[model samples]
Target: MIEYRIDRRSGVATYVQIVQQTKQALRMGLLEPGDKLPAAREVVEATAVNPNTVLKAYRELEREGLVEARRGLGTFVRRSLGAAPADSPLRGELAEWAARARAAGLERDDVAALFAAVLDEHFDSTAKEQENR
Candidate 1:
């Protein structure tokens, strides 16, 4: 069973909320490859959300190659893309600061500020190093 939640209060669309939560669950190994997802109707019933919303989420997941929906069957998790390092482009050290800021209750604009500050610091340090050389 997939364990996830939809934040109705968030500005994000319902489908996007579901897609992100499902992706997080997959990345965290909470929902492993080959695990079957609830049927669209079942999901709607369980979450008290619209069936169309659930279907849209599933379609997005399918596009991302994270899940596959079978005709007359149901959706299933796809195996992880073979052994790429977890620290891909979005997992760099600089990204850690942004993640931390988000976890600390910062909004998108706040995270942007944190990112800009880090970029400025990096550029200043590089310029100083060049001057010293």
Candidate 2:
């Protein structure tokens, strides 16, 4: 079961957090197709969020073709997203790299900026290559 966590201080809307976490779980293979998402009531109980908030998140996911809500049963995952699984070697290597960065005194935001820069550089270059081809 997926547990929703609401960080009130994170500046992100509660519904968005739920949507993003659900997508993350899908990408990580933690939630596979046919998996039942937690009932809105359960998420509300766990996170102290409004039932409507949970519903809104599920609705957003459904809109994205990632999940569907049944009449009585909970929402079911429609498909998985992304190629990277939670246990992938690439994830392990990234974790080790993050640990090394932490040990070298990089703060969370600093590491995030560096990661974003690298992603932009690589993905932008990849896009250019595809355009050339």
Candidate 3:
């Protein structure tokens, strides 16, 4: 069974919560490749969320190459996401931030501030992160 939950009051959008939960499940190895996910209707019933919310989440997952949908069947987990290649821009940026944060003795709060600062300084980062596929 899928171990997922949604919080109505969370700052995150409903669809975003679903995407993150699925990603977390994949990273934790709780949901393996070829595992069939609950139907969109089932997820909506379980979470008491709108069907469109669940559909948007599933669509986002499929777009991310994390899941595949079969007509009249359902969505299933795809192969595990591969490690970032050395030349990937995101990998480089993450590595740089890790080093900077460590050097600056930053904690979670600091990282949060840094993220907010980035968003504040350049609004495009938020859209870019969202658009990243």
Candidate 4:
């Protein structure tokens, strides 16, 4: 089961936010194959979003082959994405690093930008190396 959080101030669309959060859960091992997604009505009630919005997000996930809708039941995860588990050591190290950054007075946006730069530096170089090989 997952809880939906709606950020009205965020420029991202509500449905897209749902889809992104669901995929994030799947990647983090919080949700797995056979896990039943909360009913559209449930999400609607929790987030005050339109039922169609939730359905649209679910449909997009289905289109991506990430989930399937079972009539009379609900949507269920069809497969997972990524290799990182919720309790992975890599996550622990990152959490510790984040704590240190916070203690060092880095704002959330500052940390995010720094992390994104590091990711771009490392992952982009790795991708280029693979392409060159």
Candidate 5:
């Protein structure tokens, strides 16, 4: 089971946040197939969000084939997003790198921008390399 959190300051829609967090949980292996998500009432109670917002999020997940809502029960995970574990070597190295970046005076946004650029470049290059092969 996963607890829901909302960041009203983020400017993102509440339902979108729920959808993203659910997908993130899938990626992190926190929610596996067959795992029941918190009831909409539970989410509403926890986050003070509208029931419709949670239902919208769950519906989006269902459309994406990531989850299914049973008539009598609750929404359940249907698929995984396939992410490495948090304790993986790559994650540890990235955390260390992030710490170093912070120590070197890089702000959170700067670090995120740098990482996104590098990730785009790496994937682009890898795709080109595959094409060449």
Candidate 6:
């Protein structure tokens, strides 16, 4: 199970943060289908947010078909965000790359920005190639 964290200074709403973090966990394969999310009360206790905020996040996830809430149990992951398998060879390679980046003194945000830029460039080139075809 993934623990939820909230940044009150983030300017994003607390409920939205909860929902986005859950989705991010799903994307990263930390939360898989059938995994139970922390109970709303648990989240409230952990984050000191209103119970309704947690419920709202869960409801939004349900609306997105990512999770389901059982009557007596708790919200469970219904689907993943289609990330590569955890054991994929690319994951190992990426880990090594991240280690190298850290060794090179790149901060996490800098690495993330570099990655996002490269990903965008790759997709843009692919789209242009498709258009040419």
Query: Deviation in angstroms for 114 in model 2?
Result: 1.4
Off by over 4 Å in 4: 102-105, 123-133
**lDDT per model vs. reference:** 0.76, 0.89, 0.81, 0.91, 0.87, 0.87
lDDT of 2 by residue, 29-127 (tens): 999999999998888888888899999989989998999999888799999999889999999999999999999999999999999899997776543
Per-residue CA lDDT of model 3 for 1-133, tens digit only, reads: 5756998788778888888888877765667799988998888777788999888999989998999999999999996554454456776898898789979999878888888887688765644587474
Minimum summed lDDT over a 10-residue window in model 4 is located at 124-133
Of the two candidates 1 and 4, the one with more favorable lDDT, higher being better, is 4
* Candidates 3 and 5, the one with greater lDDT: 5
- Per-residue lDDT tens digits of candidate 5, residues 1-133? 9998999998778888898899888878889899999999999998898999999999989998999999999898988886666566788899999999999999999999999899997776543452353
Best by lDDT: 4
Between prediction 4 and prediction 6, which has the larger TM-score?
4
Error of 2 at 23 (Å): 0.7
Off by over 4 Å in 6: 102-109, 122-133
Off-target runs (Cα >4 Å) in candidate 5 are 102-107, 123-133
Write one digit per residue (lDDT tens) for candidate 6, span 1-133: 8788999998778888888789878877889999999998888898889999999989989998999999999999999996666777788999999999999999999999999898997766543452353
Residue 106 lDDT, candidate 6, scale 0-100: 100
Against the true structure, candidate 5 has what lDDT?
0.87
Which candidate number has the best TM-score? 4
TM-score, model 6 to reference: 0.80
Taking all chains together, each candidate's TM-score versus the true structure is 0.59, 0.82, 0.62, 0.83, 0.79, 0.80
